[model samples]
Structure formats: C-alpha cells, structure tokens
Target chain A: MTVFYVITKFLTFPGAITKALFEHIMCKVLKLPVEDTRCLRTDEMCGHIEHELVERPVAGFWLCFIPGLLNFLLGMSLSLFGVINVYCLGNYTGFIQNNALLSNLFASALTGNANLVSTVNFLLPILFLWLGFSMFVNMAPLPEDALMMKEQYKNLNGFLKVLFAPSYFVMRIGAPLERYGVTFILFAVIAVVLAIL
Target chain B: MDNENKNEELFDEASAIEEIEENDQPDVSVEPEQPEQEQPMEPETEQSVEDETVERLNAMGDEIDAEDLGGIPVTPPDDDSVDEETESELCVMCGEKPADKSFGEDYDLCADCRKRLVKAPISFASILFFILIIGVCFFGFLLSASQLSTLQAVSDAYDQAGSNHLYSAIKSLSSAGNIGWKTAKKAVSLYNDSGYLSGIASMVDAYFYDASASSDTKLTWADKVGKGNLNAPWNKDVKKIYSDYNTAMDAYEKYYAYFSEYDEQLYYGEIAVKDVPYDELIQKYETAKQTETESAGLAFISYCEWYLANMCEKGLETELQYMKAVQEACPDFTWLYLTKLTELQISAGEYEAAEANCKKMLQINADDYYGEYFRAMILRRQGKYDEAIAKMDAVIADYENNGFYYAYYEAGINAFLKNDIKQALSYIKVCYEGEYLNYNTANFYALLNKLDNNEEEYQAALDMISSNQAQLSPTVEKYLKKQITAEEMFNGVGNPFEQPAAESEAAE
Candidate 1:
C-alpha cells in the first residue's frame, strides 16, 4: 500500500477510504475547482486534490475506478449475504477477521457479531450512511465547475456529448444542482439498509 | 366462579365423554331383573336433573291413564293473591299505577317512572353506553381468566415433560390451546414484546412445542435402540440449532444495540472481546480505553487481551507479559480483573508481580474478599502449598458464602499431585456441593472417592460424565472397581492434580 493509503486507512473511519475516493472521482466528474497555493486563487482550471490528476493523466482513471468499485462493494457488502464468514477465530470463538478476500487472503477485517449496536454493525453501517450522506451534501457543483461546464459544453464532440449526457444535463443546472433528487436517493438507500438490518 | 367452571367444563366436555357414558349406561341397561341398578349411584343431593329425569319418566307412565287433558294447568287460588299483590304495588316514584315489577319486593314502580328514578332521564345512548361498559368488563375478565388457565396448563405440561410423560404434556397443551385460543394466540405473538402474562404465556407455547419435538425424537431413537438397532443413537446434530438462525440473530443484534445505548459496558465490553485480527482487536481496545464515554469500557481491553491470550494458548511466559501489560495500561482495572490476573501471574511463576497485583487489587477495593486468597495463591506458586492452605483456611473461617471453595480444591489438588491420597480425600470433601461440575471438578470427586474406597460416590461422579466420553478416559477408569494400579490408570493421561488438558475442540 502507498504511504497515503496507509495513512488514510489508519486515520479515517471504517468506510472513509471508499468515501474519500468517491469524492475524488466526483471532483473530476464535476471539474470543480480546488484551492491551490501555487495558483494564488481557486479557479475552474485549478488542480484537484486526487494525486493521480497531478502525477499522471492515465493513473487518474485507476484512482476513479478502484475506489469507485471499492466504495460500492464495501458499502454493499454491509449485508450479511454480500459479506462472507470465515473460521479465522479458534474453534468455538466465531469470525475474527471479517473482510473481503485478497488473492485468497483476508484484505479488510470486519468486526462481525460484536455487540456495539444491536441493530447496526460498528464499521459498515456508519460508513454506508456517511458515503450516502456525502453524495447529498456535496451534490452542488462549485461555481468554477459551472463555468467549466460551459467551456466543456462548447468543445464536446458528438461521441463525448452522448457519453456525458447525464452529467451534461445536470451541469447545465449550474451551481443549484438540486439536492432533492440526491436526498431522495439517500433516504432510499438508508431505508433499504435498515430493512436489510 | 360457577359460570367460569361451567365454561371450563364445556371446553373439556369432549374429554369427559367416557365418564358421561359410564354414568348413563347403568340407567339405560336397568331392567326388572336389575331394578336395584336403576337407583342413582350418586347421592340424592348430588344427582343431576338428567339422572332424576329417568325416574320422573317412570312415575309419569304409571299416572298416564288418570291424567286429564288440559290446555294449561291454572291454579285459581294463587291467581286471587297475585291480583291483590299487584294492586298493593303502586308506582313509588309517580304513584300513578300499580307496578309491573317490584323493586326489592318492597317499593314498586311503573317501568317509565322506574327508568326516570334510577339515575337520570333515560336515553338510548345511556343504555347502550351501560351495555358497552359491561361488555368491555366481561371481555377483559374473560381474557385474564383464559390467560391464567393457559399459564396453569403450560406449567403442568412443563412439569409433565420433565418427568418424560411427553404425550400427557402435549394433551394438556391441546386443552390450553382449545380453551384459550384467542388469549394463547395473542400471547404467542406478543409474548416477548411486553407484559408478564404474555411473556409467560408465550414461553409455554414455545417451550411446549420445542419439548414435544425434542421428546418425540428422543423416544423414537430410544424405541429403535430397544429393538437392538445399533444405528439408532440420539442425533445431536447442532446445525439444527442454527437453522434459520439468521432471523434470531438479527433480533438479538437489535436487542444488543438497544441495550448498549443505556450501558456502554455492554457495547464496548463485547465489541472488545470479538474475535478479530490481533491489530483490529487491539485497535478496538485502544479506542475503548481512550473513549471518554464510559470509564468502565477501559477495562474491556485488558479482559479481552487476557482471554485472547488464553484462547491462543500462548505460553505461561506470554500470559505473564500480557497480564502485566494489562495491569500497567489500566491502573484502575476492576477488582475482578486484578484478582483473576494475579492468579494467572502466580500460575506463571510471576510471584513478585502477583504479590504486587494482589496489593493493587487490595488498594483498588479495600474490602475485596479475594485479596488474601490471591496472596495465598502466590505462596502456593512458590511451592509453599502447606502455608498457602493455612492462609486459605484463615480466610475461609470468616467467609460465609460458598461462592468458590478454591482453598479446598487447591489443597486437594496439591495433596493429590504429591500422592498424599489420605490428605487429598479429607481436603477435597470441603469443596463439595459448589463450583461447576465440569469434567475436572467431577474427576476430582471421582479420584477422592476412589482413594477413600467409597464405591457408590465414585460411581455416581463417574456416571455424571457418561454423557461425555472424555470424562471416562482410561485414567478415570481407576475409579472403577477393577484390579488396576494407580500408575497403570494414569499411564497415558497426566497426573489428575494438575488441570487436565481439554479435549480437542472438534471432539466437543
């Protein structure tokens, strides 16, 4: 793992790794301006926080894809079925390390059957709610993203226009990206999770 | 009470069918040659109207020719008094007409005048409201009575089940279900939700159903066994307990979460104890220790680590370090933890640390009864078993409750290890009747009995563990009345004085 990943893993909440990465993709998707000391001011063309955007253009895709899939899986794996149980603990003691498998080895360790909350698991539920909540609270694109959307709209080729049609429509709504839709989706996700619980 | 008994009899009327038949058969079969049998078996006072009906019919047959035909049997002498009585009964409230019905057979009132005099101007709504009140009261009374009967039936069924009369308990359950269908159904549904009655009632159904199912299986297997079927052993497959276990687990989780809200000890204590990776478990422990929410959670890490070490079979040396580490980290660890850790340290030969732990334990809880015993364990670890026993005896002198008789157990174990059978027998007897009767404890008694030559006591202790084969190990066979030497009995197994090694977890 990278030093950044290790640092984030240790410092962050259980599912924050996925949440952080999703926002990174959202940053690129919206083309939202981020503050940069070098630029002296935030602007539409300012650099993003995701390291891959500054280092290598190709790596940016991986940053988006890896965390996206991970966040989705980690979020969805909160369900008992989506997750797996193993006999890591000694006989009689139940699941010790709950996690997604890695090369037939344990990757993420989950604390299953811990009585932290009767209705909720300590790690996964909090992470899911946080990730889904972030989607609503951060729905609105930055002011600079609105200007960038205009510039990108004029330059888009026919293929690109069709490819980004959904984002394009939302981008045209500008800074007032209308959170009711996102809020409703958030509640739906929560309802489903609670029902599963 | 009479009406309630009548209702219960009505529900059980099917069960009494044979008794009714027995009572009626003699009356029906009675003939001139058996006229004496026609007499009511029951006393005259207790003879039911139905029983008297047979005699009345016979008497009516004899008088049939003399009877006169009539539209009605009118008593004119009584009619004259009835009119006089009616005339005397004037409406007391309105005093306008003679009464239709008397009030208390004294003051009389016309119907309309009585209605007004009763409480207020009578209306249909008031009458209906009175009826509704009566209806609600009667319904509530029936509900409570039915629930009580169900509870009683369930209790009877459970008692019967314990005695292995499985079908009789089931029959009682059937009666309960029939008489209290609505009450029992409500109880089964809302049994665990609230209310003591529902909770107890629900348990009856759940337990009865479970008991019936289990007994049926046992009896089926036993019947086959009696028929010499070798394959008809009791099926103890535990996968059945976990069948649809996820549903119960979900409910349990909800209950745990709700309980943890009020007590973080439940929340953090269990979370810390969960089997996770060493680092993950440590992370939880560290978090709980540092948490400002509840001070009680801090000890969770110490307890968790101690248990994890034990589970992992970490050597005594490692255990010593873990115990010290917990003590060092949690200075204010609870009295129980300190007492437990001090004992572990003594076992690990960390007597100096154990002595310090004992002092820390006493400091934390000055009135702790375990402090002196912990100090004595330190002495025992130093090979001064005799001195340790003496110290333990002093504490036991003032101790009233028999929560743990460690002194008696330890003294016996030490004496037995040294082959001092006579002393072991005497010391072990004092530890009797307390402590969990696990294999080790049972074997302790078995060994004591064998040395003391008390064949019956030894056999009972030995049989206490016939269900588990491990307790019947070859070493345990020494307690059997066989011409075996002590060394031969413990040839493969270690000396019994030490805590015997547990069987493989799979075997369990």
Candidate 2:
C-alpha cells in the first residue's frame, strides 16, 4: 500500500507540490501548529495536526476544503476551456471536427492552407491538458482532514451537522479514493479519452 | 536514508517494550517484600495493574499503526509515572518548547519540529519533469506557428496565380519545400507579376482555336516558367503538367486538321473515300488519350466521329471499333466509354451485349444509376414490361431522396407499355409535378391524355412539347419548328443519350 502510495505521489508530483505548498500556507494563516509538510508523505502530515490542536477543528475543515475545492475547480475550468476551445471554436472558425482536427493541424501545413491562428489554436490545448491533469490528480483532501471534519460535525448541533454533511461526505469519500490512486487513474482515463476525441 | 530511519525507529520501539516488560517482572516479585511502603499493594493486584498498563501501551501502538505515520512508531508518554525526568523532556527539534505528545513520547519532537522534520526538498526527477513539459510545449508551439506561417505564404502565392492548374501544381510541390528556399517563393511572385498563368490559358485556347477568337496574349509564359530558377525536384512536377497539357492539345489539333482536309478534298472530287488515313487518325486519338489532359474535348471529338460514321452507315465497324480500342488503352475513361458503348449497342439492337455492359457498370460502381437505368431500358426493349417496371421501381426507391425524377418517367413508360393506364398516369404525374419537363415526358403526357379520350388536354400536351422547344434536343427542336413530323421525331427514340445542356456543360 505504501509502495502504491509513493508511486501515485510521483505520478502526481506537480500536484503534490502544489498541495504541500497550499497546506503550509493554510497552516500559517490559521496560526495552527504544523506537523509535517512533505510532498511525498502528505498523508502523514494532516492526521497529526488535529490531534495537536483539539479546539481548532474549524480551521482544520477550512484547511482541507479550501485547497481541495480550489484544485478541483481549477482543474475543471482548465480542461473545459481546452475542450470547448478546440471543438467549439474550432468548428466556429471553420477548422475541422474532433476526429479530423489533429490530422488537419499537420495536413493544413502540408497542403499550404495553415495559418497563424490555427497554430496558436493547436498548441494552447496541449498546455492546458498538462496543467489540468496535474491539478485533477491532487484534488482530493487528505484522510485526516475528513477525520477532523467528522469529529467537528459530531460536536455541532443538528443544523450545523446538516450544513456540514456534504463537505464531510465528499472529504470522507474523496480522501481514501485519492490515497488509493483512484484519482490518478480517473484523470488518466479522461485524458486518454479526450485526446482520442 | 528514509528506510534506515524507519528501521531505527522500529528497533528503538521494540527495545522500549522489552525494557518495560523486564522492569515489570522485578517490580512484581518485589511487591510482596514492600508491605511497609506508604501505599503498598498485594503482589497479584500490583502485577495485574502493571499488566493492564502494558496492554494499554500496546493498544496505543496499534492505534499509531492505524494512522499513516510514515513508518515512525510512537508511544504516548505515561502520565501515571510522574517522575522528574518525565517532566523535564523537551523537543528534539527547536529545543525551546516542551515536546508535544501529539506523536507520543517516543517521538520527542514538537508539532512544528515534526512538520519541519518531514518537509521534503523538491526531487531532481520532479524538477526535470516540469522542465521537460515546459520545454516541449514551448518548442512545439514555436515550430507549428513557424510552419503554419510558411504554409500561409505558399497559399497566398497560389491565390495570386488565380488557383489554376499550373500554379496549383507549383504550390503543392513547394508546400513541403524547405523553409530556406527563398527562390521558390520568389518564382511564384514573379509568375504572378508577369501574368504568366493567364498567358498559358490563352495559349491553350488559341492552339485549340476555341470559339474561333484570336488571343492577343503572347506565349512568353513558357519562357518565364523555364527561367523560374526553382530547385530541380520542385521544377519536375510543374513541368510534367505543362508537358502533358501541350501533348494533348497538339494531338487534338492534328486529328481535327486531318479530318477537315479529308472532308474538303472529298467535296472537291480530289480524293477517294478509301484514301482516308484511318490508321493515322487512330494514332492521333491514341496520343491524346494517353495523357487524359483534355478529356472533355476528347469525348466531344469522339462523339462527333461516331455521329459522322453512323450517318455514313459505318458506325459499328469504324467508330464502335475505335471506342473499344480507346477503352483498352485508357483506364481513366472507362466510365465514359462504357456508357457510350451501351448506348450504341442498344441502338444496334444488341440487347445481350448491352445488358452485359450495364452489368459491368454496376460492377465498377454499384451506386451508379446508369447501370440500373440502362438495364431497365434493355428490359423494356425486350418487351418484359413487368420486369422493367420493377427495375425502375428499385431505382426510384434507391434514389427517391436524391430527387431522381427521371426514374419516374421511365417507370411511367413501362407501366404504359403494360397497358396499365392508371399506374402509368400516377407515375407520370410524379415526374410532371417534379417539373421534369422534357420531350419524352411531354410526349408521354400527350399519349396518356389521348388514351383517356381527353382531346383538349392531348392537344395542350402537344402544344407544351412544342412550346418548350428550348428544353428539347436538336432533333426535337426541328420537330417544334415543323421541320419533322411528330412520328418522325418520336419514332425509335427513347430518351436521347445526351443530357440536358446545363447538366452536359457541368459534366464537361
């Protein structure tokens, strides 16, 4: 399990770096005492923070939600931008359809029909694909963040638990799913499908 | 290094558990001898309490294992043992603050120090990975942009040359040309400035005596192309198109010139009909047929030759034979030759041969309507009216969405031949409503009306056939002008083989 974790971390190294940096900044901003900030060993850090700061469960919740939510939204936006630009804008500007678009990029040049606009359109999507995939693989919160949120919810009254239910569920489900490398697999499949399309 | 540290931690944890177990043994035995102590306990009770504490410590070890501690084993400090040394322990890292027990007593680091201890420096692999992505993206974008702009320049040159075949060939050759070839771009620009492509077109038209209009433009375009200074590979493809074009043009001129002189001298009683150079004429036809450059002109010339031969009652032996020879020589003209051969066979009443040719057309292109259409006509001529009607129905069903209204007209004729007036009228109405007004369709309208005994509409149909003279072929045009009787114009004529003028022009 640890070996799989390490491999997934390497696969998502860029996302891991961003995650570590974001958590570090969040810890300082919340004035919470830090436990660990290792990129590869991200799982070991968040679990201990709530143990040291028993009264700061709200800060723990924010620490998890903000970074995870931000990464998820950023990943979605970047990938969607690439997809819509290639398919929609490509069609609107009289470029080809998805099946023919890749070949057209080279064929247009071979047939002396390519232009500056087409070149820009071709390269932008590739850059976006890389950035979006990196972000998507690390969008889940750490398992400890979900544990902290669960503990915090138990202490809250009925209305507060209800208010926090969705976040708790997402964190609970997302953490182990991310830890077991499901997020990485999902992102890889999506990238392959998108590239083929 | 990380594995070594984890091994050390595990080893230290195991030794600590051993020490506690050993100390409990001596203390358990000495409990019976310590009755004088302030709060002494019975031996069994003391041992049981010590046993419970060890169990608690072991349970904490399991809990630590449940958490992802990066293989760092930890033990919670024993608050029950309130010794001075226990109170005096401080953080191993940043030695100012007391060691936080969040990671237990075995991990003597404070929270901040624990985080600091595990903080990793960026690996060399990750740094290289990011740099690779950035570099590939930068260079890929740069190269594509450069190639696209170069291609755009080539397209611009084609546009300036008015996109004719000569410029198109040059553009295709230079599209993949090396970026360093400034001479290729310059040559296209020079051709455009000198009005070279238009000059070439004028020279071709003048050579063919097209429309008998003299072109004022000189043939200097040939000289310009020769002096283009293009690289050898680039020059090769462009020269081939020009050479093939000239070869076809010369053949057309020679073939027509000989026929014109033969016609003139025969009219003046200067030569016998047997003196015709048929072998030389066939040679010229074969030469033009080789390049397939002036295909429309060749088809027209072949049609004229067949018409003249048929007028002289020598069509089957002369022109039909020539067409068969051309078919064997030129694969590109197979469809044209096949269609012409089928029509000639039908006119000569060679039903079996015509049917075989129709089957060959369908074998070549199954979707070709010509195959089914000609076969339907052959069936009609064979007096198999029912079978002909079914064939036409199949054609109509297959091409109904494509607006092939001519099939409805043929089906109407088949229905009429079978004496099914009601079915015939319905089919004819579909063609008429579709506005497919031609001499055949108009004549069918008149016949159907006469069969119904409606003299007024029959006369109207006849007047419409005459009124739509411009829509008719030359033979029907003569009938409309009262030069031929209706029977003479209509007898032995199904639909003419020639398409309407607009469609014929588009086909050419």
Candidate 3:
C-alpha cells in the first residue's frame, strides 16, 4: 500500500503526500479494486529485465568511454541529408535562386570536394535512424493483470472507468524507478550539460 | 444461480439493442401504419422468434399512431414507470433481471456482483477532455510565441533596411522644415560621416539660404565655403550641377508667370505715360510756368517729375527725355503728381508709402483690381503673406471665384517654398481646377504631380500646357513667354533621369 502510494504520487503529483491523496481519491471516488492498486514493482514488471541486468556493466562502460559517438554520427547523417535536399532543390530549374543558403550549398557542391560530400551524406541518415530507435525503446506496455482487476470492480458509473485506465498505466511505468536508477541519472547529467553548454 | 445469470445477460443484451434502435430513429414525424393480416410461422424455426418481435413492434407502432390521431401528445415512458409496468424488463447489458432482486436495487447486475462493474467510458471521456484542454493551451502558447517572434523579426528587418546614412539625412531634413543652421550642420556631419560631399553642399544650398541665414552660422558656413573646406575630405566626385539648376530655373519660371501678369498690369499706368504726346505738353507747361510762379511753375515741376517718375518706375529710363518733355507741357497733371510720389516711395524703399500712392490712384478711380493686387504685393514684400492672402481672398470672393487666381498660384508657390507640400498641393489643385491657365499654373501642376510621384500625369499636364499655349490670354502668354523659357515650356520640367552608375559613384 505504501509502495502503491509512492508510485502513484510519482506518476500523478511528483510528491509523497500528493500521491497518497491521488490514490485515496482513486480508491474512494473511482472505486478501483484494492488488489489491483499495488504499483507494479520493477522485479515483477514486464520488459527484458534479465537482459538489462546482464548487459548493464558492459553497456555502461561503452556509454562512458564513447560519449555521444552514436548521437554525433546520427546528427551528421541528418545534416548531410538536409544538405542534399537543399542541393537538389537548388539545381532544379523551377526552384528560385533567391534563397542564399541553398545557392551557397550548391556552389560548394560544384567545387568538387568528395570528402565533404561523403561526410555530410553519412551523418544525416544516422541521425534520423537513432531518433526513431530511441522513441520506440521508451514506451511501456499495457498490463493485462491490471485490466483483469479493473473488470472485477466494474460499475455503471462512467467517470470512474475513464479515470482508472490511464492512472493504472501511469502507476505501472513509475513503479520501476529504482531498478533503472543508474540509466536515468546518466540521462539527467547529460541533458543538463547539453542544455547549459 | 449461474443459469439465471446467463438468462439475465441474454435479456439485457436483447433490450440494449432495442434501446439503441429506438434512439437511432428520427423523432419528428412518421407515416400512419395500416393493420396487416396475421400469418403463422413454424414453431421450432429461428425465424419465428424474430418474426414475433417484429410483429409486436409493429403493433406498438400502430398503437402510437392511434394515440397521435386522437390528439393525445406522446410522452416517453419514465425509467421507473417502465420498470413497474414490466415484471422483468431486460437489463441493458444482459437478457433478464435477477430473480431474487427488486427492480430498483441491484437489478442491472446481481446483488452479489454490483460492486464489481466500473464505468470505463466516462473515465476515458474525462481523461480525454483534460488532455485536450492542456494540449489546446500548449498549442495556443506556441502560436502566440511564434507570431510575436515573427513580428519582432520583421520590425528588426525594417529597422535594418532604413538605418543607412542617406535615409537618416532624408528623415532629418524632412522633419525640419526649411532647414535651420543646426539641421544644416547635422546634414553636413552626416555627409562627412558617409563621405558624400556633392549631396551635402547641394542639400545645404537647397534648404538653407546662406545670405538670409542667422548671423553666427552664416559666418561659419561662408568661411567653410570660402576656404573650400565644406565638402567631405575623402569624396572628390562632383555631381552634375546643371540638371538641378535647370529644374530649379524651370520651377522659378512657372512661379514667375503666374504672378508676372499682375506685376505687369499693376504697374501699367506708368507705361501708359509713354503714349501721351509729352513734347507739346512740356512746351505749354514751361510757357505757363514762366507766366505764373507758385501755381504754373509748381504745376510745370510736377509735370516734369511725373514724366520722369513714370519712366523710372516702369524701368524704362532710356525714354527719360520724352517723359521730361511731357512734364514741361502738362504742368498741372494729377497723374504726374501721383507718379512722382510713387517714384520717391519706391526709391526710398518705403513700400508702404508706395502702397499709399497706389491706394490714392485707386480712390481717384476705383475699378483698378490691379492696384489692389499691387498693394497686396507690398504687404507680401513686408512679410505678411497671410494678410496679403486675406486681401486677395476678399477681392476674389467679391468677383468671380477665379478672379484672384494668381493669388492662389502665388500662395501655392509660397507653401511649396515653405515645404508644406500638402497645403501647396491643395492651393495648386484649386488653381488647376479653375479656368485660369498660365505658365505658373502649368509648372505648379508639374511640381505637384512630381511630388505626388505621378510621372505620367505630370508629363501629360506639361504636354497640355505646351500644346495649348496659344489659347492662353495675351497677358498670360506675354508673362509666360518672359518668365518661362521655350525649352522649359516644351521639355518636361526637372532633370532628365541620369543612370544609376552616377548615383553609385556618388554613394562610393
């Protein structure tokens, strides 16, 4: 119950007391079932936990040593593709020559530097691919057990059903903060440094 | 208990479909139903149950139609009343009510399971509304931010585009009407900063008359111009002065013609003295002066003075002897006496005295509009443009509205010189709209059109003036011929367009 309160507060209010209030409201007003109310712990949650446990040390060492190797390569590819689009559009007869940046880029392309072109082309594609991959990795799955628990507490009141489903999903994702603590901490430090710099 | 639950679920499912169908029907109007003959169906077939339900609904529809025709209004049955009317109305989700439960309490779901069911749709709707509100607020914030940023960027671009030295000079000069000493100094400074010497000198000369300038600044300016130190040090390129001079000359000619007629006609009485047979009159006056001392000699002196004054006042001094002979003959001529007074006042630079003489001449004969106009001119020379205009306005208002047309033209030129383009344009437009056509009016129209940036209209007006020069009054023609050059009247006034190459050189 305490864990449930902690997880719900983290999901709903970002504080311990507010989370308790939120859970109390859900139990009283929404009439969500008590057994289903437990915030799913990381140990009991879905996802490749065993794989993460095995891979963490190795992944952490590579992440620390490389420092934005993947991101830099990806960003470069995206920039190259943007350059290529500009170049092709500039050379097209129907396109206006008034756009200075595209004209300058085309002029640079005509200067016959293969290394510059190759570098631009390589970086842009890598950037888009990394962005797509990261987005797919972050999303949590719906828990079937929570859905079953909700079914047992079914009532005719329309408002309660709407509130429980999304709240249940939020509590489920928030339950695993301790297990993924190191990864989140690394992300936070990197984000802050990038923002300031 | 399970079998009863299954039965109740089926009953609720059946009833829910019926309710949904009832909700889907249009409520406004329906056709009256005709009764159909009964038909039997096989008892064991699946079709028989469907057939019974359809027949029962048709019978209910007919009953509703009968109620409508009897002028009875239809009211939907209340939920509680429906429950009371039927022993076991099916649950919306199940096929039958629970056997052990009352209709009002735990009837939809069995009593043991009443706490289990949750309203998922209502909770989902509430969550959707919350998310929508947040999303809209976020979107609105983003839109407002982007619009503000765009407006700021556009304003910054506009400021950048207008910030150059030339634009600054233009803005300052335009704001300071008839550039004062400080404004001229600022212009020179701006020119020095931008290294545009020719433009600086021309702009200073155009806006500020050094001769008429304030004492201190005039001395400084003269010293600068005298030593050839006024120009920007780095800029050596000289702009073509002839074109600007020609344009100013043309404007002056146009301005001259409009008022020159009045100048000529106003002083015509002095010129009319030339037509008088002065030699015979001078002989008679001299003979009379010898006969009498006070009356005849004084009259002879007055006659000689009048003749000489007329010649001098008309700037026809070469015919002075002829005027002297007329004075020697006409000893007691009043015209001679008044002309002598006019000459004395003019020579002494007492224009008010001259104006008083003109008034005396008008009192002797009141038909002289020209005399009145000349008095107004004296008033103008005394730096009373407003009073002069008021007098002219009265003359014009008394006669035809176009009577003091020249006054309007002069007023327009004065306004233009003062850099009041809007007032100048208004006054000039009044003259143009009037029946009077003179060189001044033509040039004024041209100047007005040029200021308005309507080149085609300006050219057309110039063309009209040139083509119809013959139709102008003789006074207008004579004045225009003297005031405006043939080249100015024919060729469109103002400088011909020079290539941008010269401007670029100046800019450098």
| TM-scores of chain B alone in all candidate structures, in the order given | 0.38, 0.43, 0.28
In the order shown, the candidates' DockQ scores are 0.01, 0.06, 0.02
lDDT of 2 at B35: 42
lDDT of 1 at A174: 25
Fnat of all models, as shown: 0.00, 0.00, 0.01
Q: Which interface RMSD values do the candidates have, in the order shown?
A: 30.7, 15.0, 24.0
A160 in model 3: Cα distance from truth in Å? 99
What TM-score, computed on C-alpha atoms, does each candidate reach? 0.29, 0.42, 0.21
Ranking by TM-score: 2, 1, 3
Better of 1 and 3 by TM-score: 1
Best candidate according to DockQ: 2
Worst 10 residues of 3 chain B by lDDT: B499-508
Give lDDT tens digits, candidate 1, residues B1-508: 2444333332233223334455765443323323433475756577554435445645554332212313323333334678776567877556778775533455456767644433332234433533543453343333234344545776676575555443345546556543222223222322222112224333333222232243534433212211111121211111122221223344334333422332454234343323335455545555655652332233344555555555445556656666666556545434325666776666656678778877765554333446677776566555566786777676666454644576666666556656777787776666545664555666777777877789898888767656565445445554455556443432222234233355311112
* Candidate 2 per-residue C-alpha lDDT over B26-87 given as tens digits, one digit per residue, 9 for 90 to 100: 44433432342324554554554334544565777643331244455544444555765655
Error of 2 at A67 (Å): 12
**Cα-based lDDT at residue B436, candidate 3:** 61
Task: Count steric clashes of candidate 2.
Answer: 2
